[model samples]
Target: MSVSPRRLRAGALALATLAIISTTACTAGGGGGNANGGAATTLTVNTSFVLKTLDPGRVYEATGLTAVHALYDTLVTFEGSDVGTPVPALAESYEASADATTFTFKLRSGVTFSDGSPLTADDVVFSLNRLKNIKGSPAVTVSELSVSKTDDSTVVVTSATPNPNVPVVLAMPSTGVINAKVAQENGAKDGEDAAQGDTAQQYLDTNSIGSGPYVLKSYDPSAQVVLEANPNYWGDKPQFDRVVLRNMDVQTQKLTMQRAEAAEISLDISGKLLDGLPESLQTSGVQDTVYFLFLNADPAVSAVTSNAKFNQALRAAIDYQGIAALYGEGAAPGAGLVAPAFPGTLPEGEASTRDVAKAKALLAEAGLDNPTVTFNYPAITYKGVDLGTVATKVQGDAAEAGITLELNPQPLTTFLDEMRGGKSPLGFTPQSLNYPVADSLINNMAPGQATALRSGWTVQRADPAVVAAGEQVTETLDLAARATAMQEWQRLMNQSSPYIVLASNSSTVVATADLTGADYSAAGWQVDVAAVGRR
Candidate 1:
């Protein structure tokens, strides 16, 4: 999920509480093209989140992924907001081996990078290899796939196991292709080895070296990112000549949109805030992002949280409906790790419901009565919701079940650092889907995966059922079979209760009355910047 500025100085949580009471307000109208008149050549977007990096390899956050989608092209892409199927992008066509262990892509002819350099299979090989070799947060997605150039126009990716979700995985922003010549000439040092350090980290953080619709004109980590249309782009010209991504606080974002200083505001806004906006500004349908509470199960790090019964007690104690109400309209209690918008997601069940008596009994069985646990969350709001408020609600609910939660709110960067390093005993965080496949959820929760690590579970202690179910989802190619596998996997995960899913809130993008075609991707975190335009 995207990280926003720190909470308001005072009374922010109180405002959140009041906002939940007014969630029944009417939904905002849809955006149209230049309803106010006059053509717009440049688009200004104000957001609460700041950019982490411009480099495709290092960018894994929601805000960074939005910029990467506009500035880079992958071998394949999800077509027309549908992430369930992959379509040709840089690659004209692709084929997978009968055993599903090897996949080949045929590059499109006459394609060139933003720098005017011709696109080739060598570039694809270099980009994919560099992605895995870099060993960044996104590297885990393709760590098992080996890339090799078959010729100038053909590239082959081979896997040690029979993995069938290569196409969907390739469509991810992390798999974006970069100009090999430009990168190597600038600061990219190591060839394909993981031992060498990445020298281009700093340079790529501010530069663009890809074949996408936009080129990075200027970038300021704490301010804004300016992107100009790529004249050498092989696809249709972007409707806007330039795009500006401004970093601002939630209040500032609201003020800018109200003053018409920004054409669009792409941040998570509460329903109350949306009601306060001028009717001229329209809101798109909710996007797919889920908010949850993760409990660390590593006894070495947190003895209290590691107790299975304690974890289950905490999960059962949460008021899922009340928390969902805090998000207002378009938000619902989460059914599982995967959002309900996507295919193969499990059906809504009673697993996440509140049961104070059961929770107390479970806590007693674990020899914990009125025990305290440190609950950590970012001091800042995530997307648009106030996580601090959510954490407070969790504390209140857990208290009803004879548990005391000590709230610890930290700055965004510091909170993420501690959470990633497994220093937090329990964390309140949100996760946006990376892709539409059920395997995406599996990749995050299975043994040695990203989410599992965040919850302080190492490969040695990961539940074998999760590992086996994950393998089943990846090894089976049939969609129906995968759905069944995912259901079973979700069931086992719920029983373990490493994380308690509170709600899946809709992602909203507010735009000026004139701006139109600001379509959302299937994952709902990214917008089609190239498709957006003004009258």
Candidate 2:
């Protein structure tokens, strides 16, 4: 039986019902006190996440990336809530050329993989080159950067063009360094070595061989992933000897947290639900994620959405404040395509806000009074808030401006298939930043990118001014100059109204009172397992 969107969001009761009737039992009973009457040191995190893979290069989704962060070390990383700054991780130090096209990294000595293999420049080069050769969604993280071994402890990365944000991009978990020898022995295919196709995917999918604080004990895609402390890890050992990441419904997660069967819950639970949790459970810092509605500007998709006046009307009609409220605390009405947490984002005064009268005037100018358009959205909650609620609010507010919206909500998988395939005329989607950089947002959302294609805004249909402004933002190397250039790009984008900013959200994670040291970096999943310990 297919589940309805309402039932999915109202997780507790419905999930309890489903669990009682299902033949398979949920893995909801762990992290309890030890049999000898001592407190258990194992840390169990309950989440509504389905991990895709353990392979760093192949893992692109948020949940999988979080696990990768715990298991692998990247060249650069962010500490705590600072998303703009990049700190050295595997690289002891790094320097960029004046042109910003070339970066040279000096690896830390004495670091070894879980298997005790000493980390070398060759491993860094191989891991990076392999990621690009694999050509996965995360390959873009290093796609433009060429890797070379300068010495046993040095690696040089040269970009095709000047990119000052190379270090920030490398901070992504997908750029995690892997054990080249282990990977190759376990069937990893390298450049010019895929004669029989990459056979290492399956092996790496379940096993992790990194130089981080944890080693993969086991991974079951649908159920749970077990991780144990790596004894040979060069960094500080994690407080917990064992960590279990269980995949379960949000309702089960809540129950586990209540019963003290889990130490933490990382699922996107609503603020309302979180408020009801006992004072012993508290929310950690927020992650960088933004939700928005994209209007197909291609006339071939829908003439109504393609009309500039109509797009403007829709933008003005949206209740940005109301939607932001629904997202609860730590969410603000989106200012620009990039979140305010990142550099090069527009300041508050430049962002557009709701204006009902202006919306009606635009509708009248377009000769589209009471015109109807379908707004497609995923039925599930994103980042702990129901996107369906956001769409409904848009529908009601648009009607007040003499516009009619037909809501079409579908399962996330189906919704994405249609939206990403450019079949949906209008859609609501969340853009999660792979790295805390303005370029990541612009490259994905603006003209001549994948999102532009998905929204049916082909290059020919893209606004020349917006395209030109985007180029200026891209080529500018100085951070201050880029921010200034982005202002122009954002102005052009706001005028075009291809996509209306809804809200910029920070991902929330609730944990028991005693659990501390959760790192909610803007990268979405940089939780520091090494620091999370009992008070």
Best by lDDT: 2
1-535 per-residue lDDT for model 1 (tens digits) = 2211211110000001111111111211111222223564678776655356667776776567778888899998874345667799999999998787899999999988887889898888888888888888778778899998878999999987777778877888888898888888866643566437667866776678888888877766566667778878898888787777776766777777776734565554544456567766656544366787888989987888999899889888989989988876557776677766566666766437898999999998999878888888888765556788889999999999999999999887788888888888988887765556656677667767876887777667767877788788877876667877887887777777577788876655666766666544654235778778664
Give the per-residue Cα lDDT of candidate 2 at 411. 83
| Clashing pairs counted in every model | 3, 1
lDDT (Cα atoms) of all candidates against the true structure: 0.73, 0.74
Q: Point out where model 2 deviates above 4 Å.
A: 1-40, 195-197, 261-265, 349-351, 411-414, 458-462
State the lDDT of candidate 2 residue by residue for 369-453, as single tens digits.
Answer: 6999888988986555777888899899999999888999998778878987898888888776666776655777777788888
Cα distance off (Å), candidate 1, residue 444 = 4.9
Worst 10 residues of 2 by lDDT: 9-18
lDDT at residue 520 of model 1 (Cα atoms): 48
Winning model by TM-score: 2
